[model samples]
Target: MTDRHDVVIVGGGLVGASLAIALVRQGVEVGLVEAAPAGQMPAVFDQRNLSFAAATVNALTALGVMQQLRTPTGPIRRIHISRQGDFGRVRLEAQDYGRATFGQVVVARDFGEALEARLDGLSGLTRYRPARFVGFAPDEAGHRALRIADAEGERTLHARLVVAADGTRSAVREALGIGVDEHDYGQTLFVARVRATQAPDGTAYERLGDDGPTALLPRGDRHWGVVHGVAREQAESVAALDDAAWLARLQRAVGWRIGRLVASGERSAYPIARVVAQRLVADRAVVLGNAAQTIHPIGAQGFNLGLRDALTLAEEIARGDDPGATSRLAAYAARRREDRERTLAFSDGLARLTANPSPLLKPVRSAGLVAMEAQPSLQAFLVGGAMGFRGDVPALCRGEAA
Candidate 1:
């Protein structure tokens, strides 16, 4: 006999695990399948810094995941954005919008561990670890039959709604023949932890140059999280630099805004790209997180956007009797349309404009920054986006019971 579940979420990463927890709270039977072993951590839970928007913080709090964090998180009181050779810069303060802080930055590993801890206590949830999703077949009873291979060997399962929370190269998505609009930016991002001469004062800096954007986000009381973008052609050399040499190169790229970089941690680099699925829903299956869309890391919108996807989809599932109903899935897609489009456009446009080397465009970029700082309306618009206030926010995101 095949095991049956109301919802079977593939890829037990941040988004997938969140969805499972949300559904289980709504009295829905959820089965979570993860490719990794029981004790192994997913790649998403790396040493990188994750900036959680206010909306995301609200949702996580409602889910009881925020309070469970064992690691410290740094508050983002203000954001300073500028171009290396530009005359103007923009500063956005959370106090201007009547908020304590715009967002909080947490180490990805810490956040992931928090989510995992919460998963263990959730009722009505089953976890299949060290499992691989072989394939799926359509069932006439409005469900999908899934095949899984794990340490215990092979088994069959059925799910009314199958969610793909896998990473960029989603196996479920590929099996369904979904295509993506992929754009390789020909740039690589180097991320690490660094100690600066000046102490972190709850401020985040985004310095854009001809090569790419370099961001320094407050990680804790003493260290700052660094994301340095390098051209693909020179990424290897930059990654090969010694700690002293790397610190020197980063100082040259970002200037003295954060003071000198004194110490650095292990550096990791990955190619940057913009990937959006051709479609979000198909039959009884739907995609979320990096599986549905992968945006540039310029504004730190990727994970926040994925969290919204999970929350919104969970809302839709909780409201209806049939979790796999086409109408519910359609509503999920419709609700995400506006937010997804705006975020993708903003991230992509920022990466292109800031990374452009044209001398003529420098003034244009600088003028835009100056205008944003001078105009309250423009600042509000951006602040809203940064806080994840776009479109029809779910009840959980609004700090309500869901």
Candidate 2:
């Protein structure tokens, strides 16, 4: 069997789904493929919480997805960063920027459900659920022919463009003959939702030391999402501990930044790394989200970057550009250059710099933090960039109506 569309999107996760929404809003016909079955809304996927920047909120509002998010979205009015044994720290507050908050923290499940609801409400989207990509072929015309399989049999899908928003280990990226630069940081991120004795007060905290960087992000309730980086060997030991033992370890490692940790929800861990693709587009196909780049989860730039990718591509397609044209693809790559490079370098550099345990570097790091706190312009720039406003932002990110 065969199907046809103007655009075929692989991997119907947050990024792919968002891309589909954006394209559909632009009057583009979209075919979305996902390995997950229809009506299969998995359990909240552990206790992951997303920190959304103001720019992200603007983009989602433009996409009409924000209205569907269910939960008490907590605004991030302050960002506190410190080093365990350092003498200086950087404190960023929305008061300095004249904004309510740099961003908000949203539960993963709520965000997913909101996105899924938006997908469902989309009028011109064709979804291929529980379908896996078997292979792809790029023709001389710059169109891609994809082989996908489901319960019945294999089928061919032809589209002007094929987007691989699958994930870090993307099958579409592999089949497209694109290479990636992979870095294993030798660190694992332990994530969980914990009820803290202290109220969040709309603040996000990060403390760096020899073990690694640990962050506490505000959730809807009095709960805070805890992400602690540790050696791979120690991650398993930490994950296996009982509730009391885990709380004790968390308290000792995190100290009383948010006061005592009373209880914890589901706990999970992910290996940290910096994965960058050699190229963003290949022939008539391109990669998005983690398939294109995967950064350390330190600053929470992973999904924000992916969402930007989707928004950019959607804008390109909406501009009446030929989806399969080399010029159009090149333009998309050009538009993403500054933001992509800056984000990758910043995240990677911060991870490496903080992981250094040299006594000499500590003073330099502390001085840098102090400088950031003292300079308003510098703080605004950093905060703005962190909130997804770096480089040439799409109209949607500019708070313009979609």
Q: Please give each candidate's TM-score.
A: 0.98, 0.97
The list of candidate 1 runs beyond 4 A from truth reads none
Q: Could you tell me the lDDT of residue 93 within candidate 1?
A: 91
Candidate 2 per-residue C-alpha lDDT over 1-402 given as tens digits, one digit per residue, 9 for 90 to 100:
888888999998878888999999888889999888877753433358888888888999888889998778878999999888887888988877778888989887788888898999677799988899999754535457999998888988899999998899999999988999999988988888888779888999988877678898988787888888888778889888999998888888778988889998878888887888999998888898999999998788988988999898888887765776777788899999999999898888888898888999998888888888888887877887789988878888888865
Per-candidate clashes, comma-separated = 0, 0
lDDT of each: 0.91, 0.85
User: Per-residue lDDT for 1-402 in model 1, tens only?
Assistant: 378999999999989998888888899999999987777888889999999999999999999899989877889999999988888999999998899989999998898889888998688998999898999855758788888888888888899999999889999998878999999999999999999999788899999988788999997647999999999999989988999999999999888988888999999898998889999998889999999999999999998999999999999998899999999999999999999999999999999999999999988998999999999999999999999998888888888887
How many Å off is the CA of 232 in candidate 1? 0.8
TM-score of 1: 0.98
